[model samples]
Target: MKKLRVGSVLLAGIVAAGAAWAHGGATGIVKERMDAMSDIGGQMKAVGRMLRAGSYDPALVSSAGATIAGHAGKTLVDLFPEGSLEAPTEASPAIWTDRAKFRAYSDELQEAARAMKQLADRGADMQEVAGAFASLGGTCKTCHEAFRIKK
Candidate 1:
């Protein structure tokens, strides 16, 4: 329980940090991707809040996981085309240069989210769900570190 709380806090901090980036000037595909990412972050925050509050609702977890899976993988990769880096966009050129790696990260996120959904659907315990959430957050952190430009 302690570990879960700590992990939730860390993930919340990461999501909050990303939220600090200004998306007001983003347009077109950049804005679309940003909006998608914001949705994902919102789900993560919602789940984290529930976990921290010890209100582990499997239904909510499953729904959130499904939402994340829907937005990830190919859906995420498609948002980045060649040289679509408009101002206020945080995507790194490495996303295109290391396309395979970026795709791999997207796939990982999708897989992690799917796993979480499966666990929730099976009515898994809080510890198990929290672990899956932590894995999901780790994937997001890894991808951001590799492909996002901090401002």
Candidate 2:
């Protein structure tokens, strides 16, 4: 009877430890956030192409910009942590090695996205909107150049 109780306690402890470890293993989190970001990228590209063709509705452009801001603000930072560098995670060890710079890129992305949302919300004139869009694209390019690996 005593042996059975001890074995049960050991099993419970093992299960709890596993759950804790799994939470810290963020490879899937990174992948999911990256995929979501890519979806936003594709949407942004579509909106830009439409704008270039002079057929893009301002409403649609604002909607896509809002979506990007929302996702980038909420999900981008949560994806990176101390142990996020794993296979299928293009997140380089440099992310963990150079934590400050990594965090700066993340902050810059969020800040840019927020600025985009503000510009989009204000329904500014097309020239201002186009310049804001360009600035947002520049932010993406800056971060990608620093941390993200190109496929």
Highest TM-score among the candidates is held by which one?
A: 1
Q: What overall lDDT goes with each candidate model? A: 0.89, 0.59
TM-score for each model = 0.92, 0.70
Instruction: Give the winner by lDDT.
Output: 1
- How many pairs of residues in model 1 come into backbone collision? 0
lDDT of 2 by residue, 14-123 (tens): 23322321113334777676666666676566556654545536776677776777666435666776776665555566667777776676666666666655776787
Model 1, 58-92: lDDT tens per residue? Answer: 99999999999999999999999989899889899
| Candidate 2 runs further than 4 Å off | 1-27
- Badly placed stretches (over 4 Å) of model 1 are 1-12
Candidate 1 has its poorest 10 consecutive residues by lDDT at: 1-10
